[model samples]
Target: MRNPLAAGAATGVLVFFVCFYTKLLNPTSLPAEPANQVARSINAEDTGNNRMHANANAHISWQCLSESDLRDSINSTENVIVVMPAKAAGTSLKTFAKSCNPNTTENLQTLLSKNDAFNLLTKSWDMPGVYASHFWVPTALSQLLRSISRHTLVVYIHREETSRFTSAALHVLTQWCAHGPPKAQKNFFDKVENNNHKCHVREKKLVEILKDRPQEMQMGTIELLTCETYSSIEEYAPNMLFVDYKRANVLQNLLAERYCPKMTNHSHHIGKGAEKVFVQLQNGGTEVSLSEWLEKKSSYLEWTLGLNDKASCLVQTRTMEDNLSTCDGSFIHAQAVLNY
Candidate 1:
């Protein structure tokens, strides 16, 4: 009532002290706009363009690797090397990898050494992995041995041997007869039948190679080479993943979810078109069914090797049924052919 200016000054000081104490007690109550912006920037960079980016913040539990654990390993690692055979849905794997991490390249044949492979793997700033399809293990073993790292993850995609052989053979046949005359198809068939012919000779050599060093052959064997390579790599690498081409569709989703978490929906359509071509070939034959045709081809391959049960050694009939079932009506046709 007496000194109004002095009283006002005292009130202002009290309010200031109260506000300071409140801020001190709850430091996080203030908005950190600059820090938030930086965090946002980093997240954007990590998730940009489906490119493979390093996950420094990833929580990796190596002791128990689930699908998520494998993904975390892939995301956190500097290199992921995938070895797959031809006609083993490698294209689908590549497509899935692109959707998950655009920073991947499938160029194993071109790389000479592990260092070269590593260089290619990290060519892009945020690359996740490098897929090397249609590769021979023996040829690339030296380089692969050289290129292994603590952060490296090696994956091998396995297919049924007989189905792989049939698919590869049919693929070659389809390509050879794509636009050619019927006579060209007959000639090609003749070449395949003749043991001395280039096709027959090559097939024979491939079988021998598979027997001697299954790892050297593009189409691996059931017994030695491929299995040995798999066991050896498991012992050598810190992280290794095996993808059965038979269950590729399901596994693809699991992998995509881990590597490309931001992607809402992902689908793989590799090798679908090839099914139509296979169906057309099956229907085109009037006297023999597609399975019979495949058998005849298998017989010829066995004959080249001068063995009665050589076909058994090359491919498993049960696996063939599972593989053919995926081809539209091809399995049904094969069953009819078998019955006839």
Candidate 2:
């Protein structure tokens, strides 16, 4: 009753002092969630209808890094391991790791680079200080790199499943034809072999790894490699990073430099062959649009071969030098046309 305004002002001052004292007494704790929405591919859960989007406000610690930043991380960390999944940008990462620090990187890479399982069994390969001899050897459903040191960084570069499968399929087809241009009657899928060190993530293997293995599986030289999918990567390593394969297409650039250093980036762009195709098609002059005409005619010059972007190198088996044959889709289609 004695000046309500004075009493209210006093109450406000008390509240302010209380809050300030609390802040000083105990520093603010980190938010409940860790790194948020960094991995748009994995941190995101699929809702439906074939769309990719991150979970809104989802708590996570995994960082999505660019090539430059990841290279720096690789250089700085005392012990680093890259999960080199096949048909992913692994070759390029390997190139960068070697370039960054040949000593530590080479020390680790050489132990298992031969990729000879029997040799691993028979030989007494000296273990690197860090237990990472088998880290990069990724098979489908493979466990990726992990680190206990908060200082250590673990990296996984992911390519989307379908696109990767297409690449693998193409590789197999190339291998089949490279053996000998097969008769059109032969079963293309007959007795296909598993990849040597090649893998694309498969849904089947992912389920097995999640259900079968320990959340924090450790590695040994004899360990058969498992390429880890994103869902439970945090369990394997506290500090995990997801490098989207498409975002970090450094392999192509590395290959370009190593193989054809003189060729500028734009030199790879489409040339007049494409323009000639368009012109010839236009000259056909169907009343219908040329695109629609091609659809009706069931023929169009296919350059990309389901390849969306320029690949670092068009993958081929080493044996191709000895036994090269045509695996061209158009050629195959020409053979199969009568089958339809």
RMSD of 1: 25.6
Per-residue lDDT over 1-340 for candidate 1, one digit per residue giving the tens place of the 0 to 100 score = 5799999999999999998998899997776669789888877654422223233332212122344455565577665666666667677776666656565554565565343655754577666644444454343542453346657666656665556666665555444434431452344232232232223222332244323322222344332122223323333443555455665565565555555566535555644233212212333433432234566566454345342222221222234434444443221111101111
TM-score: model 1 vs. ground truth: 0.48
What would the per-residue lDDT of candidate 2 be over residues 1-340, giving only the tens digit for each residue?
Answer: 5999999999999999988888788776424444555455544544221223222332223222344554454456555455534555555555554444333344234443554323433344432222222243332222223323546555444543334433333343344434522464244222332433222222232222222322112121112211122222323433544444553344234333433344314122212111101112234432332223233433211231222122211121111211212222100000001111
On lDDT, the leading prediction is 1
**How many backbone clashes are present in model 2?**
4
Error of 1 at 198 (Å): 23
Compute each candidate's TM-score over C-alphas. Answer: 0.48, 0.33
